[model samples]
Target: MSYELSHLRELEAESIHIFREVASEFERPALMFSGGKDSIVMLRLAEKAFYPCKIPFPVLHVDTGHNFPEVIEFRDRRLAEVGARLIVGSVQERIDSGQLKEEPGANPSRNQLQTPVLLESIEEYEFDALFGGARRDEEKARAKERVYSFRDDFGQWDPKNQRPELWSLYNGRIRKGEHIRVFPISNWTELDIWQYIEAEKVEIPQIYYSHQREVVERDGMLIATGPFNTLGENEKAFTETVRYRTIGCMTVTGAVESDADTIDKVIAEVAGTRITERGATRADDRVSEAAMEDRKKEGYF
Candidate 1:
């Protein structure tokens, strides 16, 4: 073809542009940091997008209390290294106070509960704009999201009546009690993220690579060892060479039987794989076809 920018570079440039736009448009905005690879890449992009000056926005994480220890460790250390403020919305706190009920089983996920916690956090902080690590290629509902997704005071996402996004222009216009959810990498794919990670030499959690751990086979995926994974009837745990494609609350997130222990290996494995990231690891989305969409409608970030 012609002499043009590579795919990864192009995606990076677009993401950077979006980051700056959010920074300019919103008075107070926060980047959602999960300490996962996607969020880590978002952090790296924020770093590259605004160098010489610290990221002008705070980063928030909604903790499901069923988090992987590796993710928590990486999250804390990275925030310290960047010298950025971290705000955490706790789901466990909601459960403790009888605001939400905990899922009981070998495969319990905090995906649904995170919605209320996120809404409460937003109301508490009065954040007008929230930057998420959502990608269009992940799920059907997410695919419907715009770069500047709007939400009401209830924090509900209505896909049908979305504001038009022309060219690279985003309209952050909103009324009082309503905020916007921005996704800089909405156009990115999972493979794109990994390629950028490889190209940028971004450091992510070690669990992304193949490591020895105790895992048991569940319905169709491997459920890993964690405090929230209460053993069920006939469930057996054994050590297997595995790594997580996605990390979320322990109860609902599943692991893949992978040997790709390195980032490069991971990239290769994902490239040939047919299943999408959420399809493999997320239990919440599988509850129904409109699972994510329904949650988003109810102010679930």
Candidate 2:
């Protein structure tokens, strides 16, 4: 008897193949983990990629110092469970050292500042290849990114000069001071991710589920009330049932009104949703039409 792989299994197999390829080809590589749903899924794939043997590469997180507390707690617990080494690049450290200047305003965002810190970390650790859980379906800029994206010596991405991937063959070649950003799940969609999570019983941060929280509406988005975000003079906080569609710096990542508290329910909601996750919740992306593209060119992961 012969059997064919399901679509999720095919995606899993391809990601595992990519993980093994990076481990074999790059002298030093790391997974860019943010304790978010996508990164958690990537970690699960990495675990399966090298089962019976510990994951060979360290996990890198560029700390914006404005992340949700629950996510951070979950990040530590999950890392410990998998026994993966953690390497953190502190944005606050850079700010203190005058390497990065914090944006001024009542609600300052460290999202844009993450690029320089991430680049600094890559340079500091001499990582040749970095795995990111960025899906093409999330944003327009990411949609144009290759599975194996090459960055120049300055850690800048030139979309016009990207290498062509023919027949699933990726070119991981990079010179000294340059590196490649690998997105193993580049083809997976939000619905696919939720489906995989449900099927595999993967654990994720609780913030992804619906819960009652204090939120204030700003520019037509629901901003969670927290230390990272302060209410404007005209803004007033109210209680609502909300869940995060995407996770990032707490200041800029918004929550959507929903009651999808379980994996199955979340999957159902994702399937019926028309707006992309990032477009719905990420305030930082709303800065301009090409915000993500601009950041990608500047080495933001």
Instruction: Go through the candidates in order and give each one's C-alpha lDDT.
Output: 0.87, 0.92
Question: Which candidate leads the pack in lDDT?
Answer: 2
lDDT by residue for model 1 over 217-273, one digit each (tens)?
777778886667777788899999888888777766778889997888999999999
Candidate 2 per-residue C-alpha lDDT over 129-229 given as tens digits, one digit per residue, 9 for 90 to 100? 99999999888888889999999988899988889888778889888999999999998998889899999999999999999999999888898898878
TM-score, candidate 1, is 0.96
Candidate 1 segments whose C-alpha is farther than 4 A from its true place: 1-3, 104-107
Which pairs clash in the backbone of model 1?
108-251, 108-252, 109-252, 155-299, 210-261
Candidate 2 clashes between residue pairs 3 or more apart in a chain or in different chains = none
Candidate 1, backbone clash total:
5
Return the lDDT, model 1, position 157: 84
